[model samples]
Target: MTDHKEAITILGKTIHLGESKELSFEVAKLHTFNSVEVPVFIERAKKPGPTILLTAGIHGDEVNGVEIVRQIIEKGINKPKRGTIICIPVLNVFGFINLSREFPDGRDLNRVFPGTLKGSLASRVAYKLIQEIVQEVDFVMDFHTGGSGRFNAPQIRIIKGSKTLDQLATKFGAPFVLYSKNLNKSFRNTCHKLGKPILLFEGGKSFHIDNNVTIHGVNGIKRVLHSLGMLATKFKISTPKTDCVFINESKWIRAKYSGMFKATTPIGSFVTKGDFIGNITDPYGKFNHFVKADNTGYIINVNELPIVYQGDALFHISKELL
Candidate 1:
């Protein structure tokens, strides 16, 4: 006999989430526009445990997270040994199509969460997702990356003061755990309000895939699943060595002059205030603008490309005070 179809009731319609197969559901129905539904499922292992929601591709340009999820599900690392794993690989298809960060309506889906039923396209998607998935999950792991020309260290961001979330994040064993205060309109904040602990992993950059980062992300997710007892695997994930510091202060060092950029400091390097981070030189190598750090801190992210415009953010620094 065929396995019983794992299913969820949405819009009064029973959507089948085949026990061990990838499934897609239409989030929006457009006649002239080609759009598909959101994909969700329960990778149950015939045991009982906590439910974990894995989301990626909320920003279309940050495609690395989507690829990370795909690799995990397709490679069998996401095979749950207990509870369920709900994986949404692409949350913004329109943004993904043109390799952009926002939806077709130019809205950042991550910034508009717990959205409205009768709102804009982004709001509608957020509404359906919240109703159909978020409300049903025990824990959430949202994936993200630096959007368009920015790069981030492979790190996990947990809401400040959430001991449970922080503990869970440290267990995931990512290289760094950043204490991020919840913004008013972010997906993490919405989930926090709903009492669901969500961990956000950020790395790579838009339009680029770092193979090592993808692997690290997948492994981290699996480790979190294991820690929650949703997987039977006994992978020993590490706890943070020091108290994860709160990244309460951060600033983007912008290019004062537009020219060809040459980065002098690399990501992960510590810099003092007023130190040169990079240089912007003209095509003929005559005029040059020196970019300097405004604060003393560890560089968490930097733009690798050798190009810049006035006001372009070249480096991101999180205050070391914690």
Candidate 2:
């Protein structure tokens, strides 16, 4: 018997082998009565393989991942060798326009997954994503960044379990690989329940693009595609000089007192317990207090904003594998 014709439908458009299409999923209506749509990009290869999804901007202000996806599409690097490649550069169109992390209803989009049809605006957006885009893929890569004033080192985070996902994270080749438990109602947890492997890449800072992080992200994605046999070309992937640091535990270094803070160590700095990470000083330059690391680890995220309050997360430290 001849091979069955391969076809996949998204946003009501059927894409056959070796075809690429752009479609929009209407998410909501603006105050001006205009439709807000989530743009989707799809590429299918003539040969059969695994379908993978790349999603970014769920937090809206995470611009590095958005730029990385845009560059991949603009540079024509998204052509798949086999199977399909689905890209959703911006999932929260409303939050993106407002430069906010939450929807107009003040709900965090990423916190409400597998949402409902008759729910609130955030829930409805999440529902559409799960029903339309997420259900169509076998694997997913969700890109994110440190919130607001924080900057993150390039890293890949995978929930515990799934050898396949671990291998994929290693292939992505980020400097750090974090194994953690999934959050309730988050995309990772939702996809895991559906038997799908999802890898989350956190890098840079919100609202601005970090070229270094963006380049690293693009290269890592290409390597992943190649490893999955989805890249159109047979090029050797470049391996990083240092192996990825695998960490199972991490903690947030919170400020003990509110003040104007200055960080002494940058993101990606290796630190020992009791190391002075930064110092907090009163606005008038009186009464200075230092913050020290409670555990030996690498700084994966650092708060960039000078102003701080007591108990604010100033640094995120992940234990380094020895």
Best by lDDT: 2
Q: Which ten residues in a row have the lowest lDDT in candidate 1?
A: 1-10
lDDT, candidate 2, 92-153, per-residue tens: 87778888899889999888887899999999988888887777778888899998698999
TM-score of the candidate numbered 1? 0.87
Query: Model 1: per-residue lDDT, tens digit, 1-322?
Result: 0223355443345434424545575667677797566666447666555667888989988889999988877776666766667788888987887998998888999888889989988998888788877776678888999865788978888866767976787677776677767887788889999888898999888899999789779778877776766655654444444444346567788888888988888776779999988888999967977788999987878887777888888898887555
Can you give the lDDT of residue 7 in candidate 2? 82
Q: What are the runs in model 1 whose C-alpha is more than 4 Å off?
A: 1-22, 33-35, 234-246
Candidate 2: clashing pairs of residues = none
The TM-scores of all predictions, comma-separated, are 0.87, 0.94
Clashes of 1: 3
Candidate 1 residue pairs in clash (backbone atoms < 3 Å): 25-37, 26-37, 27-37
